[model samples]
Target: MSLENHAEFKLSITKALGDQLAAALKKLAPAPLAMENIRALRPLPGVYQLYKNGHLVYVGKADRSLPQRIEKHFRKISGRRNISLDQMAFTCLYVDEDFGAVAPERLLINEHRGQGQVPWNYNGFGNNDPGKRRDTTEVDEGHFDHDHPIDLEYRLTKLPSQCMEAGEALPLSQLLQETKTHLPYVFRYQASKEFDDIAVEFPDAETTADEALKTIAARLPDKWQITALPGYLIMYPKIEDYPSARRYYRSTGVVDVW
Candidate 1:
């Protein structure tokens, strides 16, 4: 699809999510705030801001449901006397609803806060400038044929080899796509393997190995399943569902049932 069309398509989905989020907020509140009709909550992906009595305080993002996320915050702070939810009279503003969820949350928070303040949440929002792009990695020649469709097993098996050898970071797909020509086969191979290693190094980055598996699962082809094996990640392709993939990968070699 053309870039314009792709953007338009994403916008449509984002707008739908915003509507759903609005509805979810009404049901979740201790006392429902005035629900304004957000006719076009712009299809862009970004962070959302929640205001209490005109002051910006709570911020979050939802890859799937915005309202559901807002509701979660409301439920958490309903009765608490915390510094974060100091004021009342709630309002939500959709800011930076483009690129995706994770970074937008970071950008909005940083836009309001400078270096001295603690970042609101454990997750970091990427750098604020949307213009700054991320890296993308490609499948190596030996890993998969160019004509073949990219799938989970193909990507996971190929990850350690595809990543930056010494660094702990995994480049986003956009960055990999942009820098494909400059990267060598050995670099790509290392990247592919690095996916799991990065997860290990930053185990705290994800709440748990299952969560990391889910993130990795999202990048894989629809058919592949990710299961935790003893001391490694086991991937199986073309399966409808594997209860095993949901199993937790612990520090121990055994895959524990959740």
Candidate 2:
């Protein structure tokens, strides 16, 4: 019995594997992508689909933990405007760990791309901050942040240790540096020693980060201001027009000389 005919079995199974994974993921019932639900699930290796308003918007693969990767998406959405956690959901499937090398995500993405749009993957949804060098460039017209920019009105809580008490003076530099750590979104600022001499306070109770910026500006000398870019915040020593900014903050009160 000689079975040398290999055409029946393709050596490259990447596409077939991707199709199988995609089909499996599509069959799983979507669960709320909220933190509470994600935290409850044990980490699993697999491919997943993210839906916005029940429409499939993204596909991803987690070689190690499904909960951690999806949790990141939840956090990313929580800090942006024009979107809500209630409108988001996800479904996933466990793939064998050995398949991680074939790039399961690419497989899933390719399969889904043939079916419909995977908007987030192309719009830089999972990308980190583009950094200060790219700040001046306009965000791609249809990018995720362009469509649902960061919410300056997003409240601040669980602040880092460097945060100061309401009405308590703290160096502006330290305050800005520490505040960004807890944020689910990006906050960038120009570094300056001058910020060390400036002291600012927080609201009596937890409040919007935008309000904090307003309060911080109250003590900053002339020319120091905070600009609310579409996707993040930037504090600089001088007020210059930022074409990409949604708005700007300035000294709304006279700095106390005492």
Best lDDT goes to which candidate?
A: 2
What number of clashing residue pairs does each candidate have, in the order they appear? 39, 0
Q: Give a tens-digit lDDT track for model 1, residues 1-258.
A: 645544333345544554555454434333223222222334433345555555444456766555555544443333222223345334344444455643555554454465323233422221121120111122233211122211212112223323444444453333323222221111121134333333322113213334434544555444445443211234444342333232432222334343
Q: Candidate 2: lDDT of 133?
A: 73
Q: Which candidate is the best by TM-score?
A: 2
Model 1 misplaced stretches (Cα beyond 4 Å): 1-46, 82-86, 89-98, 115-258
Lowest lDDT block of 10, candidate 1: 126-135
Can you give the TM-score per candidate against the true fold?
0.27, 0.83
Which RMSD values do the candidates have, in order? 21.0, 5.2
Query: How good is model 2 by TM-score?
Result: 0.83
lDDT of 2: 0.78
